[model samples]
Target chain A: MAALRQFLTLNAQILYWTFVAPFAGKPTVRIDAIFQQMVRIGVQAVPMAALTSLSIGLTLAMQGSHELARMGATSYVPDLLSITLLRELAPLLTGVVVIGRSGSAITAELGTMKVSEEIEALEVMSINPIRFLVAPRVIAMIIMLPCLVVFSNYIGFVGGWIICNFALDINTTKYIMRLIESADMMDLISGMTKSFVFGWLISVISCQSGLAVTGGAEGVGRSTTKSVVLCILVMLVVNAILTGMFFIIEGPKG
Target chain B: MSETKRETVIEVRDLVRKFGSRTVLNGISFTVEKGDTMIIMGGSGCGKSTLLRHIIGSLRPTSGSIKIFGEETTTMSPQQMEKLRLRFGMNFQFGALLQSLTVGENVALPLIENSKVDPAIVDLVVKMKLELVGLTGFENLKPAEISGGMRKRVGLARAVALDPELLFSDEPTSGLDPIMTAVIDQLTMDLTQKLHMTAVVVTHDMASAFRIGTKMIVLGAGKRAGMIIAHGTPDDIRNSPDPEVQQFIRGEPDGPVPLKLAPEDYIDRLLGHDRDKGLSY
Candidate 1:
């Protein structure tokens, strides 16, 4: 409960700094800082994200074709793969990958800064540590996570294609057409929305844990671990809630 | 000097800070005047740093009032505090330079962020500040690459980048050798004289404190924790009548400040029966 409150408070502060402060003539974070965070949190995580998505896609295609082929319904493999990847797997897997990669790194970096008094130094310099340090990272994560999900979505389709073309011997044109027809605007929107929320959660939780660190080196390590664990746990729970909501609204996708 | 005409820069009165049930600062009061270098000294955990934090508006007092530049600071909002902080500078115990940024970038941070100065001028000021700290060409180096003493000097350069009217330093000479300590002290003195900057320093180094402090206060520890035991000039502190003040100034281990743990805990810990005991001190 206290963690939830901390999350909300940090998020509110981030919103104020990111969107409202510039209008109020207060110091907002620099664009360069946001760009730098984009490179660190988003750009650097590409390979790991790509690998995770491709592996998931390949496994799903192989498994789906094998299972459906037993019923002589192997043609349904692209439909299954597309809907599963677009509506569920892509965002969820990408979120988990980012949580491990960028999320833990953010927590460790901020935790080290907190213990070493760098945050306090900024505070004493009349610089709001939240505005200067956190807002840019949060904004970058928000922007980057969706981009990653889109990229992962495409890469996941490619993985499915590789299996369909070489191993399954399915017609490439039919497979592509069926996959495209299986997913719609709503599927992409739902996945993008989930990725957005996941990005916010991962960044906020990571920053909160980092800023609240108390001890020295041991404290930073502890908080980094805690942040990652908490991020994964919370993301899973929230993912369920979001999926349920979407399921009810979309009402059992055909 | 007319008392009323002299400007009071920082006025902390009846300030008390308690963490949980343990009181850290008790009814502490002090005033800093313009161009005055005030040194706050005490044993470790005696609330000297806590008092400094309160004065700098980082920590709030449990009770009492703190006024900075005649404005009540304890009640000021974060925005108000930010505005007030622009007028003062604080050098932390560690250099506290952003590890992500280079030393030059660290020094230029305040200048670039707070003002609309040209990038060329910001670089010039950074160079000048670095030169002031005798780190002229070390600007491009990452903070991690610098020595501890060099980092402290860089911290000083960054702290004074804006040429603030007031400066606060926490243990500026703690870990450095004697020569480096003297060098840091000299730089501080130079800034104070050249900029006419009012200064408040928290340190236990009697030599450094006496070298630059125009006024001094020593906080007590143990039974007398959080209370000021001595307040005066260097000569006055040297001639202080209180045994606690004398003991602290003369660096005597056996005095009013107890060096050992309480008798029972000491015996228990020595006997290895304190394994389950959390920190009681």
Candidate 2:
């Protein structure tokens, strides 16, 4: 009961501070720090994101084409691939990729800072960690994740199109034109929404894990892995629930 | 140049810190004078580090007052408090060097962010601080490339880089060899004295504490049945009339604090999840 109380109190503080009044007024954020953090989180995560998106897109196209051909609707593969990539697959895969790749690293970095008392060191140096360490991350994710999701979504579409055209004998131009005609603005919005939330979730959850960090190297490692796995799982579960809600709200089609 | 007479830089009165049901620091009070090395000594889990944190304003006191350089800490706004914190320097128990940053970069960090100090001059200052700690040419090395001792020195360099008027260290000699301990103790003394800085060290190292602490504060239960049982010069503290302190300073290996061989009794206090997690370093 004590532990549970402590957890609730902490979470309450996190919610109030992060969403409500952590700081009463805005402070001028260091542009350089945000850029540096962006490089750390987004730029460094490219290869893994690319690889995951490519595989998922390729597999989806290969399977969707074979399945659609039975219904004599193989030409609808482009529309199918585009809708799935923009509305669901791209955001999910991109988020999980970032969670596995950079989420754990973020935990370890902040965890090491916590364990070595560097967080205290920052306080001694008169640095506001929320503004200094955390704000940069939150700001960077807000700015970069949407862009990264867009990139990933585009790459996924291209990968799927390439597979459909070359491997399954569909015309790439027809695929592109179909995507343009059928994929609505909502498709992009939903993908971007998921990506944004996932980004916020990763940073916030990893930071919380960092705060809970103890021991030395081994402890840091454990926290890092835990933060990543837990963040991914939570993101996926939320993704599932939100998707179901969205499908119900948006209905079958307009 | 003539040396100025040292004055008290830090004063604590009726300081208290509690973690829920358990009170870690209870009504502790002390003063750390300028150019004096004050060591806070206690057994494991006796709140030495907690006391240090309270003193540093990392954790606020539940009640009572703390003044550093004569400024009341708790009254300051967060930004105001942050500005005041810049005047103090501290080396953490685990030597909080950023593993991703090279030693030189780490040492130059405060200068880079807080001030418009030139990078070249900052680099020079870092090298000089590193040399003072006997860690001279390892500037380019990442923290992972160094030994524990070297990491501690790098941390010291970074701590002292800003030329703070007060330096705080937690367990400065905790995991070091005897030789390194001696060197670090000497370095701490030399640096503090030369800089005319006051130092407060939280340590379990009796020899280093005795060797360096101009004044020492012993935190434990039962001597006077209180938190801070002894606070005086090392000589005075050693010869204290209190039996608990006598047992401590003499290293008698038997006291009310126990010798860790109580067996079944120790296991009886096992926190099940913590039991699985084992003892922490």
Candidate 3:
């Protein structure tokens, strides 16, 4: 119960600093800090996100082809792979990857700062720590996560095409046509929407854990571990709920 | 008697703080006049640091009134307190320099954050403040690259960058050698005197405390913990008759501080028994 209350309070604070407070003329958000975080959270994360999505795409194509061939419907491989990657796998896998990568990194960085008294130093300087330290990272995550998901979706589709054409002996022209025909804009939109929420969740959870850290080195390690685990768990649950809601609103595709 | 007519920069009345059931600061009260160098001295965990934090508005007192420059800080909102903090500077024990930023950048942080200063002017001020702390030409170096003494100097530079009316230092000489300790004490004295800033320092170092303090207060330890057992000038504190104050000032190992536990209590602790009769171990 305490944890829930803390989560709600943290969420509200982050939202106020990032969105509402700026509109109210506070303008506490630092553009330079946000850009720096974008480089760290989004630009540096491309290779890892791409590799994970590509591998998942290849595995999905191979497994889906095997099952479909047994039913003599092997040509449906492109449709299955594209639809899954676009609607579910892309956002979910991207979120998990970032949770381990940037979420844990954010926790460790801020946790170390807290332990070192840098955050308290900021407070003493009369700088709002939430605005100076947290809002930028949260904004970066919100902006970058969807872009990463979109990149992942594109790469995953290409990986699926390679597998369907080379490994499964499916024609390239047919695979591309089937994928394009099966998946629509709504599939992409829904996945991107989930990615946005996942990004927000990861940033908020990690930053809150970091800010709440006590002790010293041991506390930072604990907060890092907790941030990663909580991000992944919450993203999974939120993904499930979002998927259901999106399904109802947009209806299932393909 | 004439001191009462002087302007009070900080007025702390019956300040109290508690962590759960354990009261860290009892009903403590004191006043710091303008240009006064008030040193808070005590052994470990005597609430010296806690008191400094309260005066700086970093921690809230359980039941007390803290007025800074005649403004009631205990009842101020965070935004109001932030504006109030601009007139004061605090030097933390461990330096608290931002590791990611270079020394010059760290020193210039206040001006940049609070005021719309030109970048060139900011650099010049950073250079000047660093030089004031005798850290000239060390501007480009990160905090991790500097020594402990150097980091503390940098923290001092950052603290005084804003030219605040009041200054607070927490254990400025804690981990330094005697020479460095004296250097920091001298620097602190020079800065306060030169800038005409009211200063409050928390330290257990009797030598540093005596050197820098015009007025002093020593916190009592044990059951009388957090209570101010002695308050006077440097000479008065040096000649204090209170056993606790004398024990602390003389740095005696075996005095009123109680170095050894009683035999019964020692045995009970060793056997994992509760000190109180009704409590289970």
Best by lDDT: 1
Worst 10 residues of 2 chain A by lDDT: A13-22
The C-alpha lDDT values of all candidates are 0.90, 0.80, 0.89
**DockQ of candidate 3 against the true complex:** 0.67
2 versus 3: better TM-score goes to: 3
Measured as a fraction from 0 to 1, the native contacts recovered by model 1 come to 0.76
TM-score-sorted candidate list, best first: 1, 3, 2
CAPRI grade of model 1 = medium
Q: DockQ of each model against the real complex?
A: 0.77, 0.48, 0.67
lDDT of 3 by residue, A1-254 (tens): 88778888878877888778878976477889999999999999999999999998889888998999999998889889877898899999988888888999889999999999899899999888889888899899999999999999889988888888888777888888898898889878888889889998899899989988999999999989988988888888998999899878877544
lDDT of 1 by residue, B102-216 (tens): 9999999999889989999999999999998788899889999999989988998899999999999989888888987887889889877777789999988988988999989
Q: After superposition, how far is residue B198 of candidate 1 from its true place, in Å?
A: 0.4
lDDT by residue for model 3 (B1-281), tens: 26558788899999999999999999999999888899999889888988988888888999999999999999899989989988988899989999989999999999999888899999999999988777899999999999988899899889988999998998888888888788778878886788778999988888888889999998999989989999989999888999988888888898888899989888887867754666655
| Model 3, C-alpha of A24: deviation from truth (Å) | 5.2
| Over 4 Å off, model 1 | B1-4, B258-281
TM-score of 3: 0.94
All candidates: CA RMSD (Å): 3.3, 6.2, 2.9
Better of 1 and 3 by DockQ: 1
Model 2 C-alpha RMSD to native: 6.2
lDDT per residue as tens, model 2, B1-281? 23565577999999877788677788888988788999998777888888888777888878889998888986667767877878888888777887767999888887776777888898889888888788888999999899887887778788888888888898888788888899889988986778778899988888888999899999885433228988899998988887778877777788765667477667757644365576653
